[model samples]
Target: MPTPHRPSAPPAGRVDAIVLGTSAGGVEALTHLLPTLPHDFRPALLIVVHLPRHLPSLLVEVFSVRCRLPVHEAADKQPIQPGTVYFAPPNHHLLVDRDARGPSLALSADAPVHFSRPAIDVLFESAAAGYGKRLGGVILTGANADGALGLQAVKRRGGVTLVQEPSTARAPTMPQAALAAGEVDFVLPLEQMPAVLRAWGDGGAI
Candidate 1:
């Protein structure tokens, strides 16, 4: 796992990409957050929600209706398109490969980091490395510590980092872990996060 680095405020700006790792009580937070943005919002969304290793994830189907943009499972080596939401399904580890051209998803067999094949650190580190300062990471409600190290990576790379307030979270363990790690950029309740994310998504809040 990458070292923890947190900032009270991330430099004011819009991120080109947004990566979210969530579990436990994610549906409520995500449903609250996604529907607030316009259908054409530009930033790409990469999301991972830890699921039972053998079950098929229906998250994409469920979120697509709540989200304005098209939601789909990520395809390995497929180029990421703007204004779309991509999800990690079942047990595969989803990652991004960054080169001079840009970032694209890579499905990997690397052993689980933090005991999660779809580890939050894996996505955050790869995304931070791929998008650099233009990335954003959000770690929502979860029962475990999977995302703590990953959210730190996003902050270290100058990307925005946010945590759904533990008090507001249906499950507080993940948010509390993130808060203890460092002062995140936003410790807002789920209801208020969409505003910040929307403004950020559209190339800086106006």
Candidate 2:
């Protein structure tokens, strides 16, 4: 396992949104993290989890029951709302775009990255571009290296970056790859993530 870095405080502004990416044990990992978020937690959450292209995703249904905030499958041109969680639908690349109305969700069927549509890199990179310093990127447990470069992009854009501690991950490749690719603000066990995120949502320094 890589040495855990001390948590770095984000720049002097509240984060407006967070992008989370995962695969493999993602459902279990998210269960541990999202359910703990308070109902009034600020900041919108956008998520990408690798799923079979042929199958419809049930993430919205699953999480809506478990989470305090509203959960939905992301839709093209959907307006982003704070305190909500949006999951990328299977077979599309979820992206963030800003227009006159502010940041909104965009979906694309462009070629897959790392052999996965709704690739973590796609979502992270686009969210970094759309939200810039107001974005937060998190790479969780996964079987592939899909989120590494995306997390780097987030860092490059002056956004906060975090990874699930590889030592505690069910499939450590994604988190380990993210740590190897660039510096991260935090590397934490799943049990500790909710508190950190709650702090972020509360506009408190990490």
Candidate with top lDDT is 2
Q: How accurate is candidate 2 locally (lDDT)?
A: 0.91
- lDDT score, candidate 1: 0.83
Total clashes for model 2: 0
Candidate 2 TM-score, C-alpha based: 0.93
Cα lDDT computed for each candidate against the true fold: 0.83, 0.91
Number of backbone-clashing residue pairs for each candidate, in the order shown:
0, 0
Q: Which lDDT tens digits does candidate 2 get at residues 1-206?
A: 97664466444335889999999999999998999999988889999999999998889999999999999999999999999999999999999999988999999999999999989999999999998888889999999999999999999998888899999999999999999997898999999888778777776666
Error of 1 at 76 (Å): 0.4
Off by over 4 Å in 1: 1-13
lDDT string for model 1 (1-206, tens) is: 96553554343446888999888888777888887878878889999888788887888888888878999899899888888898976688888887676788889877877677788878888898888779889989988888888888888887888898898888999889988887588888888887778767765443
